[model samples]
Target: MSDPLLDVENLRVSFATRTGIIEAVRGISFTLGRERLGIVGESGSGKSMTGRAILRLIRPPGRVEADHITMHGEDILAASEARMRQLRGGRVSMIMQDPKFSLNPVMTVGQQLIDSLRAHEKLARSECRQRAIAMLDEVAIRDPERVMGLYPHEVSGGMGQRIMIAMMLLPGPEILIADEPTSALDVSVQLQVLDIMDQLVKNRGMGLIFISHDLNLVAKFCDRIAVMYAGRIVECCKASELHKAQHPYTLGLLNAVPDLEHPRPRLEVLQRDPAWREALSVSARS
Candidate 1:
């Protein structure tokens, strides 16, 4: 079989606080092919940190260490700042959790998208504007031209998120690491955004690392699911078989999801096992 588009091994992230080293992401590894791979877990499970570490976005006071992170055979961990810049948006783009925070408040949406496009490629202003509008339309934005002229604050949360998606896709990245891309949107808009991502990933054959805390949603959207807990991936399995996940944490997470059909008065609380922190394990059900 061919190699995966993104290969991560023994990835670790930690912060040097006044107290001591706080390991946010323990040694965990995974590979991404041209398919949708979901990282699902509760909050503070190192889901977003893993995604950011893959993109080399960790800031100072925070350290990211990895055995090796290879993107298309290039060692990402050793890439220069310039090379990392080229890879960041050109080869790997990320749609953050909230658009209001990611988008430039003072800049017009069109200008931001055009600037991003121009940053990666040399395109004329008129051509860039046209492409930006087209990209906005591709994300299901209504009246792309008008919306493009508006500022980030002028748009709704859902529209802003879509605009962010449009900007990210304009670079033609081979991989997209979306960290809770739809958590801020309403249910209707959430579905639309998810559909946009689903169609785009399938059509472009891009490798997707969807980072979210919603197990059921991830199971539905991704081809495979990686269950993270206490900074470690305890299980990796086909999304269809997530119900039969073996790890105690995975099982706990599954049971914690409130069921509408069965109408349970109270959902089961997730119990943490002491041994989870001592060892990192990856299941092979996928």
Candidate 2:
């Protein structure tokens, strides 16, 4: 088979604290192809850090170390800041958790989307506007022309998230790092956003890194699931087989989820194990 779209090895992220150095992402490794790969863990388990480190988004006082982070044979770590700028939205786009904080409060939706596209592509102003509206339509936004004139605050939460997705995809990136993209939306809106993302990824043949805390949601949406704990991935498996995961940490996570059909008196609490932190991260490269 051909090479994977992206490959990461021995990736670590750390921050300098007054006490000492604190590691957020402990030497985890994974690969992305033209498929959805889910990284599921509790908050502060380094899911977001891993995603940012891949794009070298972690700024100083914090450090990103990796043996290699390659995209199509080029090492992302070795790329210059200018090259990274070219890669960030042009080749790899990220949809942050909340659109409110991510979108510029001063800009209209149309300006942000058009600017994002212009940053990566040399298109005429008219062409950029047309593409932006078309992308909005692609994400199922009705009356794109009207929506474009509206600012971020004017749109509902669901529409804001959809606009963010549309803005990210306007660059035609080969990889998308979506960090809790639907966390802020209602359940129905979450499904709508996920369906939009799912269709887009399949249609564009892009690699997707879906970082989420919802284990059941990830299991349903992703092709494979990487169970992370204490900054390490303890288990990796096909999403369909997540129920059969062997790691104690993975089992604990699974047991903690509430099932509607099999209602239990109480959900199981995850008992933490110190050894899991010291264990090597499971590779999610298959």
Number of the top-ranking candidate, with lDDT as the measure:
2
- lDDT, candidate 1, 1-286, per-residue tens: 1678888888999999999999999988888889999999889989999999998999989999989999999999999999999998899999999998899888999889999999999989999999998999898988999997899989999988899889999989999999999888788998999999999999999999998888889999999999888888889988998878888888888888888889788888876778988865573233
**What residue pairs clash in candidate 2, if any at all?**
none
Badly placed stretches (over 4 Å) of model 1 are 283-286
Q: Where does the lowest 10-residue lDDT sum fall in candidate 1?
A: 277-286
Expressed as tens digits, the lDDT of each residue in 166-227 for candidate 2 is: 99999899999999999999999999999999999999999999999899999999999998
Give lDDT for model 2.
Answer: 0.93
After superposition of all CA atoms, the RMSD between model 1 and the true structure is: 1.3
- Candidate 2 Cα misplacement greater than 4 A, ranges: none
Backbone clash count for every predicted candidate, in the order shown:
0, 0
lDDT of 1 at 14: 98
| C-alpha RMSD values across all candidates | 1.3, 0.9
